[model samples]
Target: MKRRSLLKLGLGGAVLLGLVGGGMALLKPGLVDKHMSPSARELMRAVALSVMDGLWPAPGAARDAALQAHLDRVDANIGGYPAAVRAELSQLFALLSSSGGRLALIGMSQDWPKASVAEIQELLNELRLSSLDLRQQIYHALRDLNTIAFFTAPEHWASTGYPGPREIP
Candidate 1:
């Protein structure tokens, strides 16, 4: 084993490993272990926009910040769930990330972000009324997460006529 031969072998091994890792990542995008992947986050962001469309009327940066904050809250909540629950949610997110699953579940050939608010509403209604338990469950999960995240924020308290707490220090 000369020095040049050893260097070439090491580089070859690294390249091979990189190729394998990349291939595995492409084949099993659902293998996210700890937190939601970027694709899942994007999907959820689109869902949040559709689900919480009318809740916040602010335009420009205000609306963007609110949506991003809601997503952060939702992500934190999901991170705190038990492993089994997280795994289920991850699987669902992965399925929805795929084109086939999106078409089947959402009944739309277009991307989630590109789907109009009306299209999203229609799909949501279908899911809500679906005979399949999983579809209904997914709808409830997304709806509940979005609603809870939006309403529970302190900034939105005025909308609910909730005055600040009376116990001033």
Candidate 2:
């Protein structure tokens, strides 16, 4: 009876573990890892704003001023940004830098919209995926910075050396 009871308990625990694992897997079937950081967030915003301007050129000077303001905010202090901070920013810039310039070219071209419905859809899908891919890289890089900070706050802060990362926080 004692042996039988132990076996039953062991099996029940295994079943419970399996059920918990399966539930979590089903709950987030397509989970993608992500992180958030100030620099990454700012850089992503800059890229997104650029992309927006590309798709719809701000319509006037006020909008252009706002966009430049945003870009300046992100670019400030970037030369000495921490490695983790730098990595995330660089990854985001790469995505947009490579393809962002030509967005207006494709969008305004007659060949794209005039293509067959399927082709047009494909083009749109490609654009969507590329944007998503860039966003994801930004997210991961930002998240990585956050995680590094959590465990190793001082590693990257030394970039500023004596005055490393503002003490306000």
Candidate 3:
């Protein structure tokens, strides 16, 4: 083929490759997993610890692992919701993750992970008592999701006086 035709073909191939690469990148999950964004996941970690304070394992590897398990369950539960609901949750999580949002909503200037249990409890209490309906809803949603995930485990059932499902003989 002539030099011009060869050059044209090469450029076309490059363009096609670029387009395909960009498409794949867009489709890839990036920072957000199937159900939660990175910030959202981070926020949930702190929230879980706070909401399950007395119930949470003592600070150690076991506690870390338990927190992750609960977060995974929470993620799975969030995945079951419709797209719109998921989007709203994502937005809420992201907002809470930000410094400004944390201060405004939770009244905490420190990072979520660093915030003490008392601080978190206070923020949650404030949220629950807030005159704003949205704040109250946010508090309930976070508390309920964490509780549901924590109690879903069989071990937690014992604490609640719930025996494992009984099979009919």
Tell me the whole-model lDDT of each prediction, alpha carbons only. Answer: 0.75, 0.41, 0.76
When superposed on Cα atoms, how far off is each prediction in RMSD? 13.0, 17.9, 14.2
Per-residue lDDT of model 2, residues 41-145, tens digit only: 443443334333233245488656544444344344454476665544444433223222224212423322133435444444455556566434444443343
lDDT of 1 by residue, 1-169 (tens): 9999999998997677556544444565543655668777777777778887777767789888887888788777787889888777766776677776666555668877787878888888899999999789989987887778777889878887988678978
**How well does candidate 2 match the true structure, expressed as C-alpha RMSD?**
17.9
Query: Model 3 Cα RMSD, Å?
Result: 14.2
Please state the error at residue 100 of candidate 2 in Å.
Answer: 12
Write down the TM-score of every candidate: 0.74, 0.29, 0.76
Per-residue lDDT of 153 in model 2: 35
TM-score of 1: 0.74
C-alpha lDDT (0 to 100) for residue 119 of candidate 1:
82
Q: Is 2 or 3 the stronger prediction by TM-score?
A: 3
